[model samples]
Target: MTNETEVDVIDPVAQIESYTKKDFQLTRLPYDFLYGLRNNKFQYSQMQVVMADKASKEGVKSFKQLYKDYLATYHSDEQMLAVNYTEFDGQPFQLACGSYICHDDIALLNSNGIVEEICNHPVLPCVRLVNIDDNTEKLIIKYRKGYKWREITVDKEILASASKITSLAKYGIAVNSENAKGLVKYLTDIEDLNYNEIEEKNSVSRLGWINNHGFSPYVDGLVFDGEENFRTLFNSVKIKGQIENWIEIIKPIRAEKNICSRIMLAASFASVLVNPCDCLPFFVHLWGGTEAGKTVALMLATSVWADPTMGAYIRTFNSTAVAQELTASFVNSLPLVYDELQILKDKKSFDDMIYKLCEGIGRDRGAKNGGVQKIATWKNCILTSGEFPISSEKSGGGAVNRIIEIDCKDKKIFTNPSELVSEIKQNYGCAGAIFVKWLQQGDNIETVKHLRKDFYKKLVADSDVTDKQAMSASLILTADKLINEIFFNDDILLSVSEMQSILTTRASVDQNRRCYEFINDFVAVNYNKFNPEKDGYNGEIYGTVIEDRIYFIKSKFDAVLQENGFNAKAFLSWAVENKVAFTAEGRSSLTKRICGKVCRCVCVLSVEETAEDQLLNNEDLPFD
Candidate 1:
């Protein structure tokens, strides 16, 4: 009997397997046996018998207690196990698990012999488990914010530290402190688990509220919400009224009777639609005197995508260039409208703003952590309005070329401004959506590019419009033609002649012409200061009376130039090259000696003569 008992003890597999297969009630398992099964030294069948026998002998009350104790002892010493999980992007990640356990509330199996459940605890979507030894492990987890992801690594000691769950929650994880051990165990044991499986699928993108998949938080449209490979349509925009109301509001502007209104409204809609095509972004500066319907035109433009309220779709010039850049980035691919250009305090900032907007990219900047920040970029039309043209006396040809200035001198463009404004406030943003939907129907981007190129070449060949201006006009014309024919059923066709006339007017006032205009305006405003016969003059004449001769105090001349956005030296060079101003000796000079002191003076024909000279030199000049 002693020898037989020794044999049974020595080879316990049969007993263990038999007890495991039996339908028996048990409570506890032997520590050594549980540990062996956890470490793969014994099979699961052997573990069952050891646990049942131990529970029976020790009076373990319930299977739950028995299982919990078994797991505790099994996972006491960290052991590496294979784990697999799928990321939010549907990518698979594999790692070694260090420990695992069944959750308390989520029961999986509640049979006579076995009770199992999964750990119900929030865990890092992705974690790296490394075994340092039989008793120690390291874990690396990935934390995500929007499109950016960061990895954090910690040892077992650090993970087990106080408030570990709270620390993890700071990184977008939610886990109960009591379940931390179980979570670690489950992650270590599970061979396959979906880390980011959610009912509603939403992915992160680098672009501001606008996703790379062409979904924008601000614009109403169809969005694909799910994994990139699989997506479902979601209507993102909530319209306040029926689409017919919007059409009713736009009908008056679109009617053939109001050509200016039709052209302006079409251009506004075209601006929003042209973003998808391959073309350079340009500005449409609507300028005229007070009450000339410039603001109404701007409101018309703003109504295409958003409310025309002062702070809604239309931004003001009161903001800094940096703010504008950020706003441009946020609006991505949407027309940016700036109202009342006169509010721009600094001319240089305005010039920089125009160039930056036209360039379609922001300045390179560094982050707080010494890393370079992502540069903001956009492709869309910029609409601006003011009493005066955006291109001023100090603007360069490059800056002037990027803008298509429209003279909104027709104050009667809208019969009742108040009523029209009220209509637009109630009915807007539908046309923009319609335009986007129309574009998404087919592959029309290539067609747009081809048409833009063709129009650009034709404009260059037929008119004196510069290549850049031609490019800008061509995009608008192409969009106008397509929109009139396809979307509006050819209601308001924007002919090449109209585009040519617009470009011709803009081309007439180049940088040189603007400088001359500024000079004339300055002389007019300070005529008394320059004339000896005027009451303002205390003593002698401030300017030369000789024919084709003009003299100004160097200090006063620089002040005027600086106030108008011109660098005196550069403007002098430009003036001399253009024959707008010259020195007495027929030489190019910015400063000369007058009254035993250095002063600035220029010899030029009368304003009338200069206008004639301009017309003779540039046939594109609009003035006689």
Candidate 2:
């Protein structure tokens, strides 16, 4: 053991140098570190020795000294940054920087901790204006160079490590190694000194209750987590003129010969009714010729709740289905209004969208960081306008219950659409809140349920629409009844007789039946694609025609069905059940000679005759 009183000194500089091989000055080393060098107990490593020696000898106690003298050593005193820009546009812009710099952005840089440079792999300023709530990581960051405070709430993972902290340069914050160490120290210091808990919730925008309370976006306790996209949406849902003004102008239109105006208005309120009535989403697709003014009807519907601008609440279908699903989740209880369904990516996908949108839950998606993304859910009616029917013969019968296709035929919906648009643009978003207020009132929900049930019964008894269709239509009718009674003094009641046109049933939505017809038509036109029995035909052989049966090459048949957007396995199974197809005795498909080649095939009755012919020849009828 070394002497307790005597100094057991070894070379301190040599110990640090041997451990790290870095030269460090000895101006600021404590005497204790030199004494502990004998037992390898030097607490200050070589890196710390170098950092302590090099740390600004001019100790910056206040933010002012640290910002101007120390921070400027790394970057120019006159730091120019981009000013006054939201991460996105068309929303209320609140810059997070304590003050936005109108001219060139001189970042006191770290003066207010708003326009900061954070430390990362390269030790650069990755984040700025680090606003935190208490000890929690509910961070709001400042961007732009102007005096305005446009703040965006960021995730805490931004502060995790070198790579994560570096990604904050996306907000136009200048990042370099200047004053990085001092700024990093300042961030750690402020975290302990300042502790104010701000109320930031991930509240989604909707028509009904916000934050589990009644429907007031403003005066609500929770500050939305800086998703100003929803701000753009909610800002448009402002109350302009009086509710009486809206009713005065729209009541006459509701009474017009065209049932479209009434249906559109009812469907607008029907979105909020979906949750209250406890039903899945349904579509009210208004379709017609180009001159039928379906867009005008859509505008009227959108104006009932928000700004009637074309791209505002009423958007085009010129986007991906993923975008639409996110939008649906965003506007949970509001009308998911889409204009020009003709511009959708494809009709087949749009046909599938009805079932998807009605399901009220988004598909589980994988995140880039090898994690699951949040699945979105919503219950609301979808309003669509297009030149042709949204759902066609290719659609399944179940989709029929999800969609109520309105045919405007050749009739023009409005005499003066331009004038109506002008009036609505000024006086909108007045009635949606009023309608919701009545629904949210104490004990009024039972009335809505009873009224919906009564409407459902009447619709089923009177119209040929299916049970699901009748149930969906009843919600619309219930909304229409309630809104008329509450808002318009029951003056603009939508007639059940007029609305029944939407529920009027005619042809089948059965995809299997349509596939059968499509196959018959396809075979007639594509006979040259088939092989002949003579073995002298010149072309690609899709199948072999033998007597009354066509033996299709299995691969070619599946490819054809897939190309035309039909499930091959599903169609073949349906065909077998209906006796339109013939399978091998012990197998699902035929192993037969097709086009003079022994291969797997799907045997189907020719367009001219069916295999039901064999059942009649059996002579096994009990009645006989």
TM-score of each: 0.61, 0.68
lDDT of 1 by residue, 427-486 (tens): 766766666666555676667778888887888775677777777787777767776665
> lDDT (0-100) at residue 371 of candidate 1?
81
> lDDT for model 2, on a 0 to 1 scale?
0.63
TM-score of model 1 (CA atoms): 0.61
Off by over 4 Å in 1: 1-70, 73-252, 256-261, 272-277, 285-319, 338-348, 385-398, 406-443, 457-466, 504-507, 520-543, 553-556, 578-580, 583-593, 596-624
Candidate 2: minimum summed lDDT over ten consecutive residues — where?
Answer: 82-91
Clashes of each: 8, 16
Model 2 per-residue lDDT tens digits across residues 175-262:
4346434333433333332333222343323334443465544324434443456667666766778788888878778768467778
